[model samples]
Target: MKDVQTCLNAMTVDVEDFFHVSAFDKIIKPQDWDQYQPRVDGNTRRLLDIFSRHGVKSTFFVLGWVAERYPELIKEIHAQGHEIASHGYAHRRATEQDRQTFLADVRRSKNHLEDLLGEAVIGYRAPSFSIGYSNEWAFEVLAELGFSYSSSTYPVKHDLYGTPDWPRFAYQRAEQIMEIPIPTLKMMGRQIPIGGGGYFRLYPYALTHYLVNKYLDKEKQPYSFYFHPWEIDADQPRLNNASAKSRFRHYVNLQHTESKLDRLLQDFRWSTMKDVYGVNV
Candidate 1:
């Protein structure tokens, strides 16, 4: 709540259906997305309405596959004056493949999304925070793909993704790509998750709420917060029967999310990440 009201300056929205999550790796294939239920359309539209009400603009990191299939959504996001970005052609994480594979994914996805939106896509984020330590070199691929900025690194350590060694606040020119690592606040001598993804969902909103303003008071850096539309839709069916830990991570705070979001809107002066970081290029 405090982050949105007292500290938040930018938001990043990943446009993907629920099933595209890596936790469903075994059962889901790209071709199987058609069978995906309810689609993200309704949920995302609600999200847009909320942002609209807040007069907030965010960068929508859309999947090329999703954008290709749902150009209207991409168009709508752009029509509303937010930036359109690539979240890869399919939803595969960059860590799922080697450099060659990751390059291909970035190249193809960029081409596809730019074609659909009829504008150059300037930013990219991996499916999950897929460009952690080992694959930090993937920045070269993104720059080569004609991207000028990226938001794929998470400045924390985690089983699925994060790069603790990476800069916590937004920094740029590493790999010649302006990198906007996801929002995190320093805690107990280490970085903590407070921006988006499972961390936002799993933790108590009060805790996240306090941490954001606490960091802002101490550090003076604008905070970044993110959430998916699927998260706001507490009833969005569990996309897969994920592991106990993953399930807890993904679904822990679904019930309290909407109220928490309402609280955030009331509290924060939120906007998109690029404006916060000054990455207008």
Candidate 2:
């Protein structure tokens, strides 16, 4: 086994509620998001408590909408010594927005987080890993807004968002901001995603453990994992109107996520994105 204390990886939380997910965007409009019960505060606090127990510090890529409504929650997260980053305003995908709109969205979120934390918020992860080849200009916008790095691209093939040709590891973009693609393992000439999110919940704990170990041993790089605040909240309201695929992806194994995360935390050392990648925020 790899020495847990020596292999520091990045743990990130996309601080959005169940309604904010892109999977439900077609069914649940952003303007109607207020109608949903505010469960993010409780769910996120639960995650914070879990991290506290395990002595882990993670980066929270918070939505501007959530931060606005739960400013105290944002303060509490920062007070706990977790890194505060942006998940853009309204959870709009970068691919869905024009360059100008994308810039405005990210800037709005970053400014809100910085205002709450009283520090620079430099890291960004696009909604749904939405920054792909067509919207590569998004990187220039991120750079122009003074973001130090972005974990906005998934270099694996996926139905919603991915650029299989993008670098599978952290690489500096020509636009000047560091682009940290979500971690994947190349096997049988394919990039298998082992980073986290629905994939983490879908796979059994033992399989995930083996795959993560394989990635670490073969790649010899930090494994960055991400999941949403609602992943652990099995009791959260379900959008029955969403597509069958979306519902399955969002709701599958909800009860097991927290336990799996606890194991993941104990299995490896974790830190903020800035710390793991040596990026200044």
User: Among these predicted structures, which one has the highest TM-score?
Assistant: 2
lDDT of 1 at 268: 69
**Model 2 steric clash pairs:** none
Which ranges in model 1 have alpha carbons more than 4 Å from their true place? 1-8
lDDT of 2: 0.91
Over the stretch 1-281, how does candidate 2's per-residue lDDT look in tens digits? 55434678999999999999988989999889888888999999999999999999999999999999999999999999999999999888888899888988888888888888889999999999999878889989999999999999999889899999978889998899998889999899989999999999999998888888888888888889999999999999878888999999999999999999999999888999999999985
lDDT of 1 by residue, 150-207 (tens): 8888878787788888687667765778888787777789787888667777778787
The C-alpha TM-scores of every prediction are: 0.91, 0.98
**Weakest lDDT window of 10 consecutive positions for candidate 1:** 1-10
For candidate 1, the TM-score is 0.91
The CA lDDT of each predicted structure is: 0.77, 0.91
